[model samples]
Target: MKKKDSNTIAQNRKAIHDYTILETVEAGMVLQGTEIKSIRNGRINLKDGFATIRNGEAYLHNVHISPYEQGNIFNHDPLRARKLLMKKKQIHSLIGETKNAGITLIPLKIYIKNGFAKVLIGVAKGKKQYDKREDLKRKDINREVERALKNR
Candidate 1:
């Protein structure tokens, strides 16, 4: 069998523009049997996804995992909340930090790691409109510089 580095299923590109990621951690997912199969087929969307803690358990919210094509009867709900697996210590810390103003948890990406489904959770703060605009300007500048270098 060949060992794979990762099989990225979905990403939340909006998270990058809306939040300034302070920390990132890989977390395992609690998926139903059919849900995992759908994720393996890259039928997932993280566009509207976020994470929260309830009763000390972390759950991913708003992530859309399309129902498996063959899972006619037992397919999981596409937008149902899914549990995220993480250490007790990590969960506690995130909970504490989120008590402060403007800090929240965002799910950045979903991927398969070593054959297990995992989500990359980012501890992030909401970015101001100006911050996002500045980032875009910088990106354009970098793109133009690369293009000029290519032509030289």
Candidate 2:
């Protein structure tokens, strides 16, 4: 199997463990110069980030992109809400999905693709405690099976 590219800047592993992702969409971000510079330096965090569709637009919240060290006066806010660029049809579809109870838009990861910063958003459903436990058990079982096969 091939490994993921180094282009991935940040990932929200907690979001994956806490929510069941039903679908994923890639969206571009409208970032300031310093913000993009910081991202390229690996100074971004997606652990607490989430996406919201408001007034027919998608915005990302709680993602932190630290200010560039040399940016000085031009540095952007570290925790500011950033705009996400998506097609109108995609935004409308996300609006419908998010209106359903327990459904939400979560930022799964950020990566640089073809010189552009992209966010991978997941349409997710909240998982109950038992559901999380069950998922953990299933993962453990899969790992054990893989180990057994490797040793055979």
Candidate 3:
């Protein structure tokens, strides 16, 4: 028996800076052949992408999967909305949290696990200006501490 390794593609670094992530879930993406190829080639971007629970299902929107170089007409649309596979209960809960609690659904990372593409989605709350400032302050403090320790 051999252990399998997970391969990660692009990650949304802006999401962490803009939102406070509460919980994360791994969901499978419904992709076409060319789209899959594009993703495997690291041609995907999740910077402005988000997930939404609509009509009892989750869909990823604004995700850009570049056109596959080899596919002429069969290349999928770069900004097409893709379905995300998750349990029914999870979908319902997410819908409630988004609609009632005012949380957001953010796609954190896209990765290949066991030969299938999986997305790590997070339940997040938008960060306030002060919160972002606090994060920056904390980072600076940590950097100062590390520098002091190195010089000692």
Best by lDDT: 2
The local lDDT score (0 to 100) that residue 26 gets in candidate 3 is 92
Residue range 14-56, candidate 1, lDDT tens digits: 9999999999988999988799898889898898888999999
Off by over 4 Å in 2: none
The 10 consecutive residues of candidate 1 with the worst lDDT sum are 1-10
Candidate 2 vs 3: which has more TM-score = 2
CA lDDT for candidate 3: 0.91
Sort by lDDT, top down from the best:
2, 3, 1
Error of 3 at 95 (Å): 1.7
Q: What are the lDDT scores of the predictions, listed in order?
A: 0.90, 0.93, 0.91
User: What tens digits encode model 3's per-residue C-alpha lDDT throughout 1-152?
Assistant: 22433488988989999999999989999998688888899999999999988788899999999999999887798998999999998888888788746588999999998888999999999999999999999999999998999999
Give each model a TM-score: 0.91, 0.96, 0.92
Q: Which stretches of candidate 1 lie over 4 Å from their true place?
A: 1-6
